[model samples]
Target: AVVSFTGVAVAVVSFTSIGVAVVSFSDGSVTVVSFSGVPVAVSFSRISVVAVSFNDIAVVVVSFASIGVAVVSFSDGSV
Candidate 1:
């Protein structure tokens, strides 16, 4: 799925069978909550960006001019 604002975009891709979740932003930043029941992975650029991942939980928050702040959370409580 894809969500977009004026100049920002958010995308999500999930694989339920393998328990994988991927979230991406427009600024070449990507956050993967979980992959095959492993850990979380996050990649971001620019300043004032925060990403957190644990077990099956992943959250990312970003702030920029004209972009405001974006927070995304993905979790299923399953390992």
Candidate 2:
């Protein structure tokens, strides 16, 4: 589904059978909330990509600005 709020286009997809949820933003950003019982992954422009695995609720958030990159991951919801 999609919703336009304040002139910004936001999109959200339900969790599929493959167990992947996608959320997209107008500012060239994409977020994945699930991966077959895995965690979340997010990608941003000019930045990098994040992939979380091997744990429950382990979310990965990646941001790229000025060619710089950042990645965050959690194992077992701690560290």
Candidate 3:
């Protein structure tokens, strides 16, 4: 299964005895997996901007599993 938003996207997959899920945003993405009966989740994002521009990136993940991880990066260089 897959879901997508204007600036975001999500995906899910399950096979045999394993399952995986993924979610993506304008500046980030996330993935969740259930392997060997263990559940795990991971997410990451990166943003870069220049000049008089404002950039904001935020990520949130919720799960009822064994492990979850999230990462984000932002860089702004201007004169």
Candidate 4:
């Protein structure tokens, strides 16, 4: 489902099989959220990409006018 609020968007997807969850923005970023699970992506002023590889998952939050990038990752050290 694609939710458009103002000029932003909130896209949500549900899965029933084993797979990977990826999220990408229009700026120039990509992201993966889960493997064989539900994924949620949100966009603001910049593009953010989240990806899930192996048992590891990555999260990134960036701003358009900011100078800082917040990166959070979780994995079993196999990524």
Q: For candidate 4, lDDT tens digit of each residue in 34-77? A: 55333444554554544333333432223322434344333332
Ranking by TM-score: 1, 2, 4, 3
lDDT of 2 by residue, 1-79 (tens): 3334454344433334453546567776667666656444454444344555454343445444443434343433332
lDDT of each: 0.47, 0.47, 0.27, 0.39
* Model 3 Cα lDDT, one tens digit per residue, 1-79: 2223344333322222222223434344433333333323343332211111122212222321223322222122110
Lowest-sum lDDT 10-residue window in model 1: 38-47
Question: Residue 22 deviation, candidate 1, in Å?
Answer: 2.3
In terms of TM-score, which candidate is strongest?
A: 1
lDDT of 3 at 27: 40
Clashing pairs in 4: 19-36, 23-31, 30-49, 30-50, 31-49, 31-50, 31-51, 32-50, 32-51
**TM-score list, all predictions:** 0.39, 0.36, 0.28, 0.29
Model 1, 22-58: lDDT tens per residue? 5556666666555444343344443244445556454
Every candidate's CA RMSD: 5.5, 7.4, 16.8, 9.0
Error of 2 at 10 (Å): 1.6
lDDT preference between candidates 2 and 4, better one: 2
Q: In candidate 3, where is summed lDDT lowest over 10 consecutive residues? A: 48-57
Q: Deviation in angstroms for 20 in model 3?
A: 6.2
